[model samples]
Target: MANEKITEEEVESISSFARISLDDDEIEDLVPQLNEILDYFDKIDEADTEGVEPLFGVHGKKNVFRDDDVGESMSQETALQNAEKTEDGYFKSPRVRD
Candidate 1:
């Protein structure tokens, strides 16, 4: 198996460019965690992929083959009759603030 050597300064430079805005204390805490994540990815890179084809999604997956059937639907007048407010046959909810 091959190994990859990563550095804290490289991670710090990336954090800076991405505007991650981590404080010194937070960056100190995240360094080890990020290194662990990268190590896991390094293991994946060591896998045998030379002859394997890359796939964007799993093969042979469909829409689960649901049966299509016509169903009843409410009329525009019946659908909006119980609202606190209605305009042009549509329900009007309270205005939102932020």
Candidate 2:
């Protein structure tokens, strides 16, 4: 894996695909890091997990919640009492999209 070096052209191609611009210095720095990552993956591929079951998660957890029962509702005025802005008796929020 150490002999399998990453080329500048490959790095440039990857940067172009990712929409990131990389100078010569940055590309040189990334070559080693990327090669190291690939080497780590190669090591992982050689691991002995023949009988090991794949784990979806590390922790055994479950959701805990109260029963969803209908409750009393607040008045319109009460609901908008703390709003910074209102329009036509409703909470007015800023426009987010064109």
Candidate 3:
């Protein structure tokens, strides 16, 4: 890919999409930094990775599966003992939506 430079307008547009407000000085500073990051990615793109298998996990460990076992559980009173609000043996929470 060609060495494309990031423009101030593009930085403003990116900040707008990210819901962030950037001053003129911040935008000016970020242009070169973002461009440098893109240049590093371009260097990475030029690497030769032929015959390399894709790695799934960095730790090289497969997921261990165990059988689910039935366990004893606390009673409703015990569960609601520390609750601030309870109604009809259930925890009551503030209404979130109408």
Candidate 4:
């Protein structure tokens, strides 16, 4: 990245590692696009955010947990009524191999 000159050997090794097959034409086309993307990230690294607080939400956050409360749960009859399949008081679905 110092000179933005990634060698053909490096490119070949990366391609092999990723198990990707790219002909000479594709590598020629990707060289500048990859270089441009890297340059953009490099430029962004120069930003000044001295006192900025890191944000997880654009809107301010509220409590992420609920207060503990004792409650009665829905009956199984009501729960299985909405299911596509129910047998022996349990939801049944297709078996997934993986």
Q: Which model scores highest in TM-score?
A: 3
Question: Where in model 1 is the C-alpha error above 4 Å?
Answer: 1-6, 59-98
| lDDT (10s digit) by residue, model 3, range 21-84 | 9999999999888999989998999989899898989988888678788889999999999999
The 10-residue segment of model 1 with minimum total lDDT is 1-10
Instruction: Report RMSD (Å) for each prediction in the order shown.
Output: 7.2, 5.8, 5.0, 6.5
Cα deviation of 89, candidate 4, in Å? 24
Which runs of model 3 end up more than 4 angstroms from their true locations?
Answer: 62-98
Tens digits of lDDT, candidate 2, 23-98: 9999988888899998889899999999999876667555657899999999999999999999999999999863
lDDT of 1 by residue, 3-97 (tens): 43445676678888886776778767777777778889879999999988977669767567778888999888888777889877788888886
Residue pair clashes in candidate 1 = none
- Judged by lDDT against the true structure, how good is candidate 4? 0.82
- Deviation (Å) of 39 in candidate 2: 0.3
Instruction: Assess every candidate by TM-score.
Output: 0.43, 0.56, 0.59, 0.52
Clashes per model (N, Cα, C within 3 A): 0, 0, 0, 0
Per-residue lDDT of candidate 4, residues 15-90 (tens digit): 9888899899888777777777878887998999799897878778666778799899999999899999988999
